[model samples]
Target chain A: MKQVLPKADTERAIDSVFAAARGRMPGAGLVPQIRARAFEVYERTGLPHRGMEDWKYTDLRALIGEVLPLAPRPNAEALVRAKVSAEQVSADQAVKLVLVDGVFAPELSDLGRLENEVVVRSLREVLENSATEAIAGLVLSTTNDSAISLNAAMATDGLVITVADGNAVKRPIQIVHVATGLSVSTFTRSYLQLGKGAHAAIVESFVPAEGASGYQANDAIIALVGDEASLSHIRVAADASDAVNISSAIIAVGARAKLDLFSMTCSGSISRYQGFITLAGEGTKLSANGVNLIRDKLRADTTIVVDHAGPHCTSREKFRAVVDDCGRSVFQGRIVVRPAARKTDATLTTRALLLSDQAEADNKPELKILADDVTCGHGATSGALDDTLVFYLRARGLSEKDAQMLLIKAFFGESIEEITSEKLRDFVTAQAEHWLQAGR
Target chain B: MALLEIRDLRVGVEDREVIRGLDLNVNAGEVHAIMGPNGSGKSTLSHVIAGKPGYEITGGQILFRGENLLRMEPNERAAKGVFLAFQYPIEIPGVTTMNFLRAALNAQRKARDQQEFSTPEFLKRVRDVADSLNIPQDMLKRGVNVGFSGGEKKRNEILQMALFEPSLCILDEIDSGLDIDALRIVASGINALRSPKRAMIVITHYRRLLDHIEPEIVHVMSKGRVMKSGGKELALELEACGYAQFEDAA
Candidate 1:
């Protein structure tokens, strides 16, 4: 295939976003530095598409082909109110950080009980209010990826959740980064920092606000699990039928740390979620599972990279997808074990269920082990529901629909059961069953 | 009074018929053993009676409690007191035995318009049933039939039958892959479930299971048909003769 330039419409759109990003910068401590660096990278990389290796199966070309940022609408307040209220998990239960249309909605949000051990602040506000040293060392130092830099430059207001050493937030934190009505392009940069011995479970759910369309949401969530800290991040997305949601999460699990990431992509037009986790310390453990349900010619891609960089570290990754009605789902999971990472046990498995003959699921589970003492394996499987099992269920007096629903429920529940929270567990299970009922 | 009446039953899987015009009946409080060689349709009789799919009922009438049992779906039959101890039980991962058993029991109960049981009440009931079958309560917490030994799987099946408490139980080779101790335990469980109102059909290749749970009638099946029917002595005669009479029917 020939390398095609950005579509004329998209180029104009990107240029307009760059001009707006440069013009919209509010002078602050770290803003000027990050914004300058972001613009440098933005000019170099432009917007990555299917041609890039990491974006190979994603084909973001369809999403980026039309460059537009949804303009902030008049009903932004109402949309933000509904977004937080509509969360399946109660706002009272989550350490809620509500971002409305790329800016923190303070009046509509609740950040409760934060002492020295915990800190809940906004990215833009953090930059404006942080001590100069903290702004330079902490805020401006971490983001190395081009996407994060790009997001940092254009992001208006974002979340900054920090935990001091040996502190664990009792309740799971819920960060709802919602893009409300009509945006041409939106950039979001959020960060989660856990110090040593800290633990937290965070759920980041992004649902397109009602009637939001014709836009690109370039999202970057950077999570750092410090030594002896354990964190679980659950990402859920329900994109509008016409909207394109592109998000990436880069997580680094430090020495003896643990990170568990679970993601479910329910409804989307073209969505790409990439997870990059670095098992940085000996005895560190990392596990990631993604369940993607796609329909109506929609395409959802989940790409994960797990690196066992420390000795005695463990990594497990599993991806399951249900594709139907000409929908396309792609899962590319890679587990890497270094030569020094002895006793590193890593496994990757991708199981896909194709509901329609025209629907397709492509899974590539790859393992690259440079250590001889490591135990690593990878497997990819694609199949329909077992006829024998279906017959067995129907024989027991279940209708065809009921039997398939039960089986698909059981099939998807295998991973959902691994979720630690019972409340979230039941909610996701019911959601999965509901999706099955919709036959999507 | 006959609790179960199978008249002119003809069944086939795919295109080939397996149960060829087989007729059998059982009165309340009676236990009947259907013995046959491999492919003799002993299993098919149990599955077909339970309404398993893929098997066409070209000609058959199964009357249970004066109702057309063949017309009922499998779970309906189960709800109406029909249980089949599977020859090969399914392995359901991530689903605990207790969870699935509770669901099955509750499903049956719901069909009967019974109130649902609380978790504690269900556990208490399950414990008693498990203890009687020599099954550990911990087994219920494990995934359904996953990684259980052959004997353990069969015992789990009987445990389910015991818990469900169906009217006319069908044991399809419950003794097939069992050790002596397992076979005795299985037969004892069946014996424990026997009631005057609850009849049973024990399908097997050997008569060893009948030793513990005595059957009132024994029938030798060959080529999808019952060739001989007699008392317990029939098992002894078949054991002595080694199925020489079965070759004539083929």
Candidate 2:
């Protein structure tokens, strides 16, 4: 017996991604079997285009010109050494979760049981031995994006972190995924499971090894917050000059659960980072923030889709982007409120600062609410820095460069200061200050 | 004997001269008021003295403490005992008043070979200053000049002056938007900082502020230069009738 999946836009988007992949190689037997199955599902629906309300500004077609291969794993050792921030992890320290050629590197992982309330290990271990069905049932390899779909097909190892019920972990677990070695397109995945009433914080940092770039790294992550559970998650992307990252995050919040997610994207050649959040249970709350500081010709496209599925859920999102040179920043955020999800309160705001005349900011905020009792709104604004502010700081004894640095810092402060850890806060602040001081 | 001496000063903005051949000298601890009509180059003199950008020094020599101020950067001039209380303070969003002030004070302190104050110590000192001025404790926590009332801006100027404590303070239109009570408090704040080693230049269009600040000498500026110099009584006389004489001269 087979189950029938609903004919939703999400399903169509997934189908289109498969079609894009299936046409790349006409294979025989097993290759076509897998490709056909994926393509059939994709044929029923296509990837969301700009016409779609959720994908109004982000034109995936423009970015998906050619399909990348999912072969040879990334060089884990080289990437780990180059991309890792010396400030964050000591030369020899850090519970590193290396993804060599897109495969999990257990030899580099450092994790231990804390108070017997949480378990941290590689995804391969959980896939082989974890008894809980939630861990297995929660993993979805099929996504609307072809790159994500490829990642789903090729995901062999990832980070598997679980928080037990009624347990609060004070120490922040760091997950560092490096792409190095034989650098063909790498498909990496991260699966995070949270138990009821469990509280924890995690920082997912991604960087490419010395030879990292021009290759695609399609990655997916799932974070399940159980009832009364809390989570503070941050995702940092500091890739090399030629790397392209297409990362996705799917979060399901249980009743009365709280989730705070801060995403910092500073350096990447071309990154299409997407986040999908589902308010699955009532009384769930979330504060999602995004900050990106891009210079040169790098491109960072951030798209977020939040679904208000349950009643009495509150979700707020704030995104700020600072673009300079010829870099382009794109933001497409959508909030969907189902009829059953009444009393849902949500707001999305995207603000971009264009430093140069050539720099461009594309922002699209959408709202689809069938519930009359729901409160959902979104706004987007893009502008250059105020000359008055620059002059004002200059008059206060700051040089033109120093004054611009201060103004940029202030502009990006709303998002950076959202990190709860003072140490981490200072670390990111220092990174931003360095970028400013370098005259970027 | 002179704290700040301007010799044959000529300042211009965008190739247009604003301060032409202006001369002024203020001895230590002296309060000089530069009173003029709206376009008489009052603010230009303050900017020229503080080394603010956009104003080209076509011809002038500004000597402060026996050093050429025109050769110094804005912050350098600020560290060299020169302060300018802006007529309209810029609103710096996300930068708290305390943080900016602390950074400024530390930058000045470093230039002066002094140790920087720790966060707690700095907070204590600021709290004490805020207490003296009856300012709300949380006001310093807010973004600089953001959403502040006009009078509050003037008070914040005084607050910055107190924090920096420069030797020569040039306040441009500090009394513009202040109320009588605020003016009195601001005047007191300035008077409290007055010492034999400090000099102040107060710019105002009305005599009401002079009544509170009590300047020793007055310079009546017409067009781009000082037309006459008189005792403090000139402010009262100008208040009684008007600056008709000066306007006619211009």
Candidate 3:
């Protein structure tokens, strides 16, 4: 019989977390048991490495070096300092939920200010109540992904939001994660459930507090859309240059439901965002799009998996990456059509613009089809700026830099146009423009 | 004073010399038609004047309004009133035609220290020019020259020429893919922009474009140099007598 070896470096880091979480792990009844089981799963697999097919391009073991200790629950004073101001995220009217260093900051949130018929609760508060099913549902997964397990074992607090049946929330929900000046690692998990025929839009921003450095954040969100429901999700990560951010979104779409997911990674020392989407019922539609503008020595990765399990469903995925200086960008997309899913239509396209000789881009698109009478395709391309287009713009009187900038913005215009909301589209475009300017 | 003076111009692409000892001069208000064969270096001459890359000016002097044109960048040449209507107009996706035009206009204005046009003023000007050129309203909203018909592209080039109002205009093979109707429309648009201060160079392999916008002088070119120079009737003579005789005369 083969004998198990001693613990690896990241495995020991997990052991330390497990030891530290002994009595402080928040949950009632089965919650602690679930957390322990999850930690066990992570302990067995350890941090994902280059050998894993899913993590082939982005090796966390190699990139993360050694895991920093889990962030402690913020003290009152530290919470105050870590709270992200409303003006810092957006001036648009939104239902704000604030999390400071992985702990719920009620004083910084707009709980009572919400006018819509929406239910919002803190995950920790719900974990202690008889909401055992809700807690279990939040952590339940078809696959025991190591990252999700790690988040479950260590997450201190997050939000639990629900839009009741037939409810259409007028204001978007804004969940802002703020890390204070302390260089600490944090884990957070959230759940969003929409009842039948419900509609809502949520914007999640990962922002480090002013002067914060060397922080690491692991976040996960589980969203379930019921029949005829619609959800718009936008995630933007602008962490500190020395920070590492890992985020995941697991979404399930019901019959005739719609999901629009858009993400942008404009700043981070190293960041990876994974989106797992499953069309569970017939006639559902989804559009998954993203943009990454990275510069300097930063690295960004966008990995998406779209599963079409329902008949007559459709999905479209588009991503654009712009790398400057010594930055690196990676995009991996997989679209799977199950046997029961017929007449499924899916398409994916990813393009990268490398602005410097040292910049790098890796794009991988895969499709697995088991159903007949389905249409699915994907394409990827990476190259330096188009010299002909630059010359064309220059011949019309634009400077070289200005011409390159114009082409870069134009390259991202397609993905931006997919956004349904005008204000959000403009905001994202402005964010892209800001990234471009910072690199210059 | 000459608007453009080319003295002993020699240009090469990579290793081979395309334009060998070419010389031509055009005064303000005069239109010069350069009739050439496929490899006569007419297009190379236009690109060199517009300051395109990938070309070595081995030995030449290209003077535009008394400035060394070769010393300027492409955008600088454009701001200084040199325009080239390319034989193949590049299709730029995701850049609306209106936006492209506005950016170009404003950049040129900024370089010349002129006040930029207001949005409404700019819109009105573009609409007027677009309407005059029979450009559909939808075309202005789409990407520049993306999915445009061949004739539409040629007309768009002429529309740009009208808008920039450059002092020296070089139209390189502008009539290659144009039908009779398109050729007539493009030529009329060029004729509308003709002024005493604006000189024009029409480079073509055929004489059809010269019918509508007649030139004051015509030069038969071969082997990178002008083999013969005559009046506007020179084009008709070349049409009657092919460039075979002049091909070796250079």
Candidate 4:
């Protein structure tokens, strides 16, 4: 294997990662070859900079600064001490899967009582056994996206979940990722395949273990929903304050399939959550919503792209960002309808609230419709809280802080109420309240 | 001492003077009505008294129970037994009425060095007050004034007044959007809270509301200062004679 000396810090960081993972990296046959190809692509592009349209608001080159070597695989002691945080927003009946430091931990996971129609396997195990055709192809191998390419090149371990046709999972499945060590970089890639007519709900959470700091985590999740399948996906990233988290979700919806995706980001010094969704068949429905509660020097970015390729599909995207103190928040949503996709109904709305004078919020909603008969619209709003409303509450006897708090809660109340799951809604609400109370 | 004393008060909104040299005195047991044509600084007086922001008191003294009222913030005034029923109550979409009231009540209590009410005790008190004001329980459960009718918002304002039990209450244009039935209900709600230890300043444009909740003093204001001070019959006399004469007087 020829070693490629790279120039940029992000690229040099990748070379070091490849050097460190010598022969122990997962995968065999086409998997290793695919990883090498991904590395080649990543080396060619380096890290996405400020010029890239998709990376405009989130400049990884500048934001990431210097990427460290891949986190040495968690040791037995580290795994033993790692526990899912108490912020699990799942019901008691949920089937939980735990990933420590980007590696699937079977001891922490409960797979014994999984439904007969569902099959869950470790991604690394599947890759090492040459049984990677289905999982490998199911994953969206981004050729140009440097982040996902880097994720693929350094992918450590994650889950491969398959739901059989027409089987509805009675309990929700939670994939909780707990970062246990400090000053380490972790990459995880997961693939979920839902057969025709299958229905399931999956929750993914990223939270660092107690006192962990300066961890960099990159995660890519690819899901393929078959025709008539319904999937509810919720992702929450509550990392340590000094952590850098970059998460991406790539979903493909088939004919008549429904995808309800929601994400909430609460802590993290620098974070970006992006979603790439495609409605491929007719009669598909997509609702993608997000809420970000960020304070201090945190910079949170949420970008979503919904591609409507089939006629008569409906899609709605809503995002709310609350930036406090010196925090900066960004929301970018784009809905694209192809020329043949007539009768498409797509609406995108993004709103941001700036809490302090130094706080900043940037919202951009775009619509590209080549179909003449399609109904597509986008709206964006960014401003400070209404002074009159604050005065109204204060005049009613609420203190200044309490008045502001009440208005902030009400601002997020409408969007949080849109969550389909009761427990998840409560969890998001509590996280938002936590952010509100974390003031300057 | 008078409950409220406004001595030659001068107030301005932005670059224009709104309330110029306004003087009024209200005893502990008095209901005063200030009426005039549009833009007569009636709302200005109410807002300045309640300490709403954006008002510059260039000259004057406003003393509440012998304490300088201008030095207090809006919430400080509220905690110090002052309430203002906004003519156009702002709709807060997320904070439920129940939550708002409890927080308000507890804030006042806390400022007064009183123990906060427990959840059950607060709910019982709110239910009792809400029942008397004809406020449905579900309305209290919903967001404050969100999607409320015009009359419902007015009633909610009165409900806040009832719950807070302020010593000096200022109702600004409280009769603007009420129908006959809602007016009667609101008037009775105000009448129920009237006591010798409390005073109210009702700013209205019509004589109908004055008829339901009769005022002890009526002052005709024009431009900024009061042009005439008389009894409750003055409201009816002004209603018949119109405020053209007062507008000229200013």
Candidate 5:
């Protein structure tokens, strides 16, 4: 006989919230039907738990004890606080698009000099005025995960950006999400599309206002790269000390396209960054890299899945983690080569540095190849700092702590250097250094 | 007072004693060469002085200028004028040689209550020293000892020895993997640092290196003890006759 158990408190609360908020959600025609379907999927699966293989190391059901109510619309005071917080992490020489408490704030964003090259709209406006087919296309999912389903049903507002054919956007587009409320949750979703031969750079930054704590942020981005186009996407997650963050990126690369994606996580009490990328066209190139600097009791995870459905595609994935005190880091990478993906080349490498006996690291790599002519390899390692290297530096007149710091910086250098933009690279490096200083 | 003093020194690793009842004295402005077989503890003495860990001092006392030497950390000992040129220089990736040199120099200087070097001043000093050693500017920009050849690694060690300007320098098998041309270049670099107020201890197994460095005294070691002590001519005699006589004497 099949055993049945009562619904958890958070699950029941989510059910009630969905029932009360469905009629109020902004969307006409197919949008509401899509939302209902997404909600049904969430109900069937419930919250991801330890029993699921994908969420083995990070049990979201257990970690998220209770789901807080949806955050209220930002008031004047909240906008002021968000502005101050967003300025600290805004990338230099980039157009800024600010989202305060999950709702797009046009007054705080600067889309100057980009009016002629691209088209941008808020997700709420698109849902309210755009065609049903366009609305459904914007919310398409590459993977059927429970958390993403939850996001599809609850996300209120985000950006919808598009670049025309052969248009090379000179400056980067930065989307900054600032949290200014306490004990609330925010869900935001965005979509980006590039025409043939188009080039663009996008950056996503998640931060918190001063004195704001205990917030939850669930954000998602969907990107489509056209043939012969190139795109560079960088995400920086520096949330509050007591915040819970879950972000996802669903990307597809077209024929002969190039994609460079990088992410760095230095804060947040519990955070997960997952990516689902597919090579839909032949002769595509992809590079994905990440770094995690976690301390105290904080936890960070980077999970990625790359599907090579086209022929002669090449992909590389590298990730590094530095764990200190009782912190924990998890990395899970999977590569799949379809039967048609002959002559595919893929490699994945992950390394972890444990600074104390209590620090923990978990790494898992999987490969599913249905083609005999493909080449795939993976490597994973987790250990403490090398003692020989430490002694060598100490003998050269550096204190023990300085020697370890230098080595830790070097450990993170490989992944950070892979970022194409020098400005972004230096900014990420400084963030890592700040984390090291705080740990000291 | 002697620059370095060792009185009845006995050292052990695990249960095995490597240095047993060894005594030696080094005075200012003198270069002493200690030659021995593989297991005669010549390297152990240098490591103990430079404060490498994992060695137990069963019974020993070492003094530098009338102060106990074993009571300080490796960095403190280095700041107090002790340097060791390792036989195999370690390769540290992602840290450029120039940056490492600056960090090490500034740290030692700060420990002695000296001001840190400004960027321009440090760069000028490094360029001058590196040019004399035939180290190209490109090599300094590369990772420390990373992808460096055997002779290049040895020359880098000499470059550091010149920059730190320590009072006591210990060279442990520095000539192990150098050709004649490379050996001459490294020897000249080492020769430039000799001073009336400085001392050096050169540990080797062959007499080829001694011909260029020209030590003032020679000590033959066997079975973790000094079998004989004499002038520079002792190195040649041992090279010709081999270590059998010294092993039998011990």
Candidate 6:
């Protein structure tokens, strides 16, 4: 006889939340069925645990002892708090889309200037109208990870952006998720589609309102780049100090398409960023990189899976982490080349700088190649800053603290330079410097 | 009082004594040279003076301008006008040479309670010094010592020495990898910074560098201690015959 174990507290809580929120969840036709199927998967698997291979370093079952209740709809007070927090993370000269407590706030968003070249619709409206095939296929068909499943079952509202064929959006579109409630959870899902020959850039920022802490944020983005199109996506996770943030990105590149993705993580007590990218068409190019600054007993993990399903594709992944004062950082990268992906060129490299004796860093790189004609390589390193370098800087009249900060900045600067937009690069660099300045 | 003083300097690394009871002194406006073979503690002496970590100071007293220099941190010593030109300058990728120089200069100035240099002022100062040392503007734009040739690295040391205007300059094997042309250029840069209020302690294994920058006093070291002391003529003699006599004496 098979033994049946009791569910964890978080699993039960999540089950109850799903039972209560199933009917209220937006979407018409098969959307409700899809949501129920997703929740069933989560219930069967429970929260991701160390027993699973993918979640070896990040065990949500053990880390998240209890799950908080879903955040309520944002009231007027919450709107004001969201505005204050959104202003701190919003980029200059970019179209802003604001989401308060996982619910899209149209009043706080500025999409009027982009109405012509870009079509913007609320996910809730799209789901309610039953015109959700695109979103459903994008979110449900990509991966079966329990976190993604849980997000699909609970997502309240997000943006659906599409660029017309051959159109070029000059300014970047910024998505700002502001958490204004403490000790609650919020879920959001967004989708972006670029038509053939279109070019655009997107920036996603996750921040917390002043005085907000101990919150949980689950967000996901599904992006598609059409043939001959180019897209640049930058995500910044700067949540509250004690918050738990889990975000995922699913991206697909079409024939001859180019995608550049970069993410920076500097806040939150516990955070994990999962990226699933696929080369869906021939001759696609992808550049994915990330930087993590973990300090003060915090834990941050970045896992990326790149699938080269088409021939003559290229992918490069570079990640850097600076861990200090008992902080832990994890980087797991996997590259898969199908049999048809001949002439595929892929490489991954991750490095971590540990500042204290108690700091920890785990780097795992995996390559699964089924093609005979492929060039693939990966390298990972974890260690403290070079003593000689520190001594040299100190000998040059810089204090010990200043010397370390400069070296740390230099460590992250390499990956930040991959950003094509000079303004965005500068903005990211300044934010990194600000994080370093706010010492542990 | 002497500008720099050392008494009974005994240094060790991992329980191995490297400098045993060494004594040295230098007054302002003087150039002193310490020449030695490999493992003779010449470089160790320079490192000890610069306050590099990992070397245990078993017994020593280093004084600069009537103050106990050993009590200060490396940066504090740097701010107080003590500079050591490394034998091998570190290569720091992703940090531009211009930014590094600015940070170093401003840090020292801030420690001394002086105003930090404005962008234009800093640029002008760096340009003047770099021009004198034959360093191109493009090199300044690149990472410090990244892909720099041996000559360029030595010349960069001289450029920094000129910029900081330190009172006590310790050149630790600055001529190790330079050709005769590079030696001349670097030596000329060093000569340009010579002032009556400043002093230099040049450490080398060969006498070729002394030909360009003459020193008033030369000390021959062997087995972690000074075996003999003499004038400029001693360097010429040592060049004629190697440190065989000094090693035998030790």
Residues B1-250, candidate 3, lDDT per residue (tens digit)? 6889999999999899999998899998999999989999998888899888899999979998888989998999999999999899999888899999999999998999999999999989888888999998899899999999999999889888888889999999999898899888888999998899999999999888899889999998898998889999899989898999998676
- Model 2, chain B only, scores a TM-score of 0.96
lDDT of 5 at B19: 91
Residues A100-120, candidate 3, lDDT per residue (tens digit)?
Answer: 888888888888877566898
Which docking class does model 4 fall in?
A: medium
**Model 5 scores what on Cα lDDT?**
0.90
Interface RMSD of the candidates, in order: 2.6, 2.1, 0.8, 0.9, 0.8, 0.5
lDDT pick, better of 1 and 3: 3
Which residue pairs does candidate 3 place in steric collision? none
Candidate 3 CAPRI category: medium
> What is the per-residue lDDT of model 6 for residues B1-250, given as tens digits with 9 covering 90 to 100?
9999998889999999999989898999999999989999999999999999999988979999989988999999999999999999999998999999999999999999999999999999999999999999999999989999999998888888888889999999999899999999999998888889999999998888999999999999888898888899999999889999989988
Write model 1 residue lDDT over A88-180, tens digit each, in one string: 434346666666666676655556544446788777777676637555344443344455556666766667889988998877777776666
Q: After superposition, which runs of candidate 1 have C-alpha atoms over 4 Å from their true positions?
A: A1-8, A25-46, A63-65, A73-92, A113-116, A127-150, A210-215, A390-403, A421-427, A433-440
TM-score of candidate 3 on Cα atoms, chains taken together:
0.97
Q: What are the lDDT scores of the predictions, listed in order?
A: 0.77, 0.75, 0.87, 0.86, 0.90, 0.90
Worst 10 residues of 6 chain A by lDDT: A134-143
lDDT per residue for candidate 4 within A342-433, as digits (tens), equals 89999988888898899998888888888888888888898898999989888877877888888888877766776787877776687778
Give the top-scoring candidate (DockQ). Answer: 6
What's the CA error at residue A228 for candidate 4, in Å? 3.4
TM-score of chain B of each: 0.96, 0.96, 0.98, 0.99, 0.98, 0.98
Instruction: After the best TM-score superposition of candidate 3, give how far the Cα of residue A191 lies from its true spot, in angstroms.
Output: 0.8
- Report model 4's interface C-alpha RMSD after superposition on the true interface residues: 0.9
Candidate 3: RMSD over Cα atoms?
Answer: 1.8
| TM-score (C-alpha, index-matched) for candidate 6 | 0.96
**Residue lDDT tens for model 2, A362-432:** 88888988888777888889899887777656555566676777788998887788777776666567766
Clashing pairs in 6: none
Between prediction 1 and prediction 4, which has the larger DockQ?
A: 4
Give the lDDT of residue A55 in candidate 4. Answer: 86
Candidate 5, residue A199: the lDDT equals 94
Q: Order the candidates by DockQ, highest first.
A: 6, 3, 4, 5, 2, 1
